[model samples]
Target chain A: DAGVTQSPTHLIKTRGQQVTLRCSPKSGHDTVSWYQQALGQGPQFIFQYYEEEERQRGNFPDRFSGHQFPNYSSELNVNALLLGDSALYLCASSLGQGVNTEAFFGQGTRLTVV
Target chain B: AQSVAQPEDQVNVAEGNPLTVKCTYSVSGNPYLFWYVQYPNRGLQFLLKYITGDNLVKGSYGFEAEFNKSQTSFHLKKPSALVSDSALYFCAVRDMWKDTGRRALTFGSGTRLQVQP
Candidate 1:
């Protein structure tokens, strides 16, 4: 089975520009979550989408939002991007809603804000 | 608030030597702990988790973690280090806030492991 897949392995955008990163969760998974990983840092939770609705969110601002489709794919949209937004955008998928379920991750989209 | 701390930013070990990446956590109630590894330019891979059971939780790639409730720590360990094992390691805690329906994994700052051949 193919693992979680993300598009645009790398991208560069200017400040205030909007960007959308896409992700396809692993087959048989139902939940998708987004995270931000700065250079030399661990991935930080952004939000999670389950059943086409945002179920949980982290400490991120309103500029960060996401959507989940019926096929369990997801898109992470960042509006009014800032310099600090330049980081690796990661998408992880899990099979269920429980806290103990293991999550499979995508390679991530590297967002570079100039 | 729930949080995870990986005290070591980097760890170096010779091949065939045992390695340990330290992690400590703070959370109310029983904490669900996890360890993940990320290689260069790749995403995080689940290593192991501690829900309920033995203190030592064995996981993928011959890795294991020790969950200490009293110490509030879950440390990852490998019996023998391999060069291919060099990567970034993260410790996470599953949390749920009282006033919010937010239940997700919170990660540590990460620890980079360098295995020397």
Candidate 2:
């Protein structure tokens, strides 16, 4: 089965510009989560969407938001991006919101802010 | 709060030798632990996970992890290292009791493993 897929393997945007990254969940998976990985650092949770509704969010600001479609595809939108927003945007999918479920990740979208 | 720490920045080992990448986690209540490996320019691949049952969990790539509750550590080990096994390893954890509706993985900084001939 096709695994989680993310588009625009690489992206470049200027400061204050907005960027949108897309993700298609793995086949048969429903929940989708987003993470931000800075250079040389571990990924930080951005938010999660389930059943077409946002389920949980991390410490990120309002500038970062996400949407999940009925087809289980998700989109990450960053508005008025800052230099610090330059990072790898990763998308992961799981069966449900449970501790035992393992998340399948996409190759990730590398966002470069100039 | 849940967090993970990979003690080593890099691990070097011979092709035939055993390898160990250490990881420690901090989380309240029962913890769901996981190990993933990433090759150059690739996404993270799930190696294994510790949910319950036996302390020893075997996963893909002939890799296994031992979960030590008292020490709050889950260390990944391989009996014989392969040159192709070289990659970046990450440890992650999340509390089972969190009300956050979705399970989020708290990842470590990652440890690079280099296997030589």
Candidate 3:
């Protein structure tokens, strides 16, 4: 089976502009979560989407938002992007809200905000 | 809050040598610990995890992690290292406490493992 898939493997945006990254979760998975990996750092949790609604969020600002569709695909939108927003955006999919299952991740979208 | 710390910034080892990458975690309650590997420009790849039961958990490739409850640590180990094993390694944790009600994982800054051939 195909693993998690993300769109626009790489993207470039300008400051004050907006950008949207997309993800299709692995088959048989229901939950999708987004993470930001800055240079020389591990990924920081952005937020998690389940049942088409946001379940939990991290320390990100309101400018970062996400949506989960009925098909289990997800989209991450960043408004008023800053140069610091440049990082690898990763999407992970898991079976449920519990920690019993290990998450599968996509190759990630490299966002370069200029 | 749950957090993970990978003490080493980078670890260098010769090919065919055994390797160990250390990780320590913090959580109010029982912790669900995980190890993920990432290649350049790629997302995190699941390596292994410790939920309960055996302290030593085996995962993809030749990776295995030992969960030490007393130390609150999970260190990834391999009997023998390979050049292809060189990559960025991350240790993540999730607080199993129901009160936290958070499913997102807290990851460490990551440790780079370089297995020289």
Best by TM-score: 1
lDDT of each: 0.93, 0.92, 0.92
Query: After superposing candidate 3, which stretches have Cα over 4 Å from the reference?
Result: B96-100
Q: What DockQ does candidate 3 have relative to the true complex? A: 0.86
| Colliding residue pairs in candidate 3 | none
- The Cα error of candidate 1 at residue A55, in Å, is 0.5
Best by lDDT: 1
Q: Give the C-alpha miss distance for residue B7 in model 3, angstroms.
A: 0.7
For candidate 2, the iRMS in Å is: 1.2
TM-score, per-candidate, Cα-based = 0.98, 0.97, 0.97
lDDT of 1 by residue, A26-93 (tens): 99999999999998877899999999999888899999999999998999999999999999999999
Cα displacement (angstroms), candidate 1, residue B98, comes to 1.6
Ranking by DockQ: 3, 1, 2
DockQ metric, candidate 2? 0.79
Residue pairs in candidate 1 whose N, alpha carbon or C atoms collide under 3 angstroms: none
What C-alpha lDDT, on a 0 to 100 scale, does residue B98 get in candidate 1? 68
Per-residue lDDT, model 2, residue A83, is 96
